[model samples]
Target: MKMVKLICVLATLLLPHLAQANPIRIKDLVEFDGVRSNDLVGYGLVVGLNGTGDGLRNSPFTEDILGNILERLGVNVTGEQFRPNNVAAVLVTGALPPFARTGSSLDVTVSAIGDASSLLGGTLIMTPLKAADGDIYAVAQGTIIAGGASAAGDGAAVIQGVPTAGVIPSGATIEREVAFDFSGLSTVRLALRTPDFTTAERIERAINAAFSRHVAVMLDAGTVELDIHATQMRSPAHALGRVENIMVEPERRARVVVDQRSGTIVMGEDVRISRVAVSQGNLTLRIQEAPLVSQPNPFAEGETVVVPRTDVDIIEEPGIGLAEVNGGTSLSEVVAGLNALGVAPRDMIDILKSIKASGALHAEFIVR
Candidate 1:
């Protein structure tokens, strides 16, 4: 009977610490479906350069493409030695945004694929950007706007950022649009990026409360099902438009993340320790080299001799009193507890690893 009373007292003492953690926002937890963009890529030419474009003799593709363009313009120079110095073959890439129309313009990124030195002061010609379906979706062309600088001396060169690539704002006109019918669906599903049952339930509740209708139903940890019939809306898009905007508290696991190279540590607010005693210290070994000279007996003719010797020493930091890290129920408390140890971020990572190994850290430890 005495042991049972002690257990109950301990549970009562720990309950308050466990209830201090707060939930995160739902927008940071889930991703909406069908709200994505497609990638479009094309090979293009950038001309009107100032002696910095590709060497026509070295790059056969550039020569062939330029020659073909001249031929199409009714210039009969087939037998003439054709060499120009103002063009570079580049690869253009851009994203085809959702709901883009035939005349919509998007920014395109042009990068030199050849051995060109730079793409400064160049104008990209009309290039057809294609999708994976072997169809052109956008046509890219404009003056390049590179955000970099380069300079060279006799023996050294300094460059900043990217010198061979640039982006043109609204440079590409959409030639075709994809056919994704969003309103024709009988049912819609929401897939949470980081799946959690609590979050899924909260999302369902938030959607139902916004419309005052139980249209959303939790299907699993990662997905929620919404019945179109229950929304009482005019269309599926109309129902999702209202449901996606509803906000709710999110759920996440306690995590302790550390970056070894950058010496950066990120811990979730829920990360905690369970009454663990910690002691961190470092041992340093140092050595010094010196040369010693010795002469045989002083008066008589003696050969002087020298020998090298090294002095070694070991140092161990003084012990800090055994400190107990109390269980942290919030992120701020967790950081305060860790900072109290007076250790650098690099050393703290090692200490965190040891704590995790001992099963005292109540969180997922991820080393990256």
Candidate 2:
């Protein structure tokens, strides 16, 4: 009882701070337009495996790619039949970060697309990475770092991690740059990660206060327009350096999120609930079969007979009385009322759902 009182006291003291939003840097709240990553993909091959490569008869693509590579290297094998267990076909993927320059290296992932057992100890051949526009942007070639291993015998096999997929750090070199001029822009638009009118207005106010002028304007709930000329700065880069560090409070709607698979329930501090009642109970059934065998005496010459017996039962455990929760205005009051029910997390999930259905819960209910 004393510990419960102490917790309640702590929660009551923390509600005031929770009622107001905390200050977050502008960089964390919004995303700058044209500052993002682009995905690049390519088809490639990996060699130097220890008999773990794809079979020629089953994977025709692997053999075809090998023949093409050999032909590119000035090897004459037009009519020659080659069978080797040291090659595999793979798909390579990587991300080209914004502002990436020519010759910059990026990490690439290689995943087997054929019937290969493993990619361990294999080296990727030169492959060209292409963007969505069908233009070559980078070239990848490096050793593979597989994440898992496996071992097999005649009858039994054991596998640990994934052996058919791996990553090559700094394997791809950028050849072309995405067309985006970051320095020549006169106005920079800030897109909110989570759109909210209160948060956008607060950001505008914070920026104008920092510059001591009306340099920032709230265009909408999700966009904030900043004028680079009003700051009298050298460039947008310099203006960003000064503005991105300023802290502004962000607002969020009252929400409750639940994960059914993991039995997790998360509620925002702004969530509220009206008066409600909840009850829970469980019923179980059981059945058992038993048989008895009988035999005549040795000299009686009578056949054996079996008798069957069965037992059945139904049980109903007594359930607690319906618990009542009064209307709450703050998060602490709501939590304290719910905690009084003495129910499991999953059980509470059902109760909360029922409450929401009856129009008691005033927050957004999300199930994942």
Candidate 3:
């Protein structure tokens, strides 16, 4: 009887902490089905480079664009052979955000598509941005803010950032809108970023509970259907505004993510480990080649001879004995056990992989 009471008390104490660990807003975990961004792309010309533009001989496209621009502006250059070094051909791209109105401006990205040396201090000429359906959506024209720069002197050069790409704030004016009527929709779908059966059920329950009714239904592990008509709300937007703030405890799978290039290791809070013994050792091999030149002694007739010597050595660092890592019941204990190994992040990654292979790490191992 006493032990049962003690266990109950412990459970009561841990419940709040566990609940606080996973509280997340619905907005962070899911996206509305119809609320999205549209891609806009355009081909344009960037001028005003300081002799860092495309070479006229190599990149004829730059010259062609310049000629066309001049002709469009009432200047005839049909047979001109002048070589200009202050212009470059570029591609402008941007996203037309959801519900963007006509005449609204958007930030656009400009990138040099030719052999231009740099896009620094360049201005994007007026260009028509088109969507995938071949309809003009926006007109982009502004001064480029290149994120990088480059400099060269004689035989040496120092460059920082990317001078061949840039961004212009509010550079594109929206000329058209996507054919989506948000007000006519009676139902909205929520798409989970990371789908799980438990998470879907939780979201459904939380949304329904907030309204004291069953307006939300879990269609699948990745989707939840919300009935806008049944809510009797002013609009779908009103319902979403109220529903997105309702916090729910999200469920996540136990996993360990490792990035080899960056030497980064990330383990989920739900990760677990069984009782395991680990040992680590490093072996290194070294090879040295030295050639000796021997001269004929005191003007002897024999030509100088060369002798080659090679040295090889193998060294192994002393490894720790098989240290037992206790099975952990919580994330903190698991982290503490791994920290006790006193290994580098990369070494820890290898050890985790070995543990996973041995079936002692109770989580999925993802290598990136």
Give the top-scoring candidate (TM-score): 3
Error of 3 at 361 (Å): 1.1
Clashing pairs in 2: 148-161
TM-score of 1: 0.82
Global Cα lDDT for candidate 1: 0.81
Measured with C-alpha atoms, the lDDT of residue 14 in candidate 3 is 60
Q: Compute each candidate's TM-score over C-alphas.
A: 0.82, 0.88, 0.92
Q: Cα lDDT for residue 219, model 2?
A: 95
TM-score, candidate 2, is: 0.88
Candidate 2, residues 319-361, lDDT tens digits: the string is: 5468889998988898788778766677678878999999999
Find the 10 residues in a row with the least total lDDT in model 3.
1-10
Off by over 4 Å in 2: 1-21, 287-311
Error of 2 at 345 (Å): 1.7
Per-residue CA lDDT of candidate 1, range 222-321, in tens? 9888887788889987877777666677786888788899777766656788778898788889999998998899688879999899999999876445
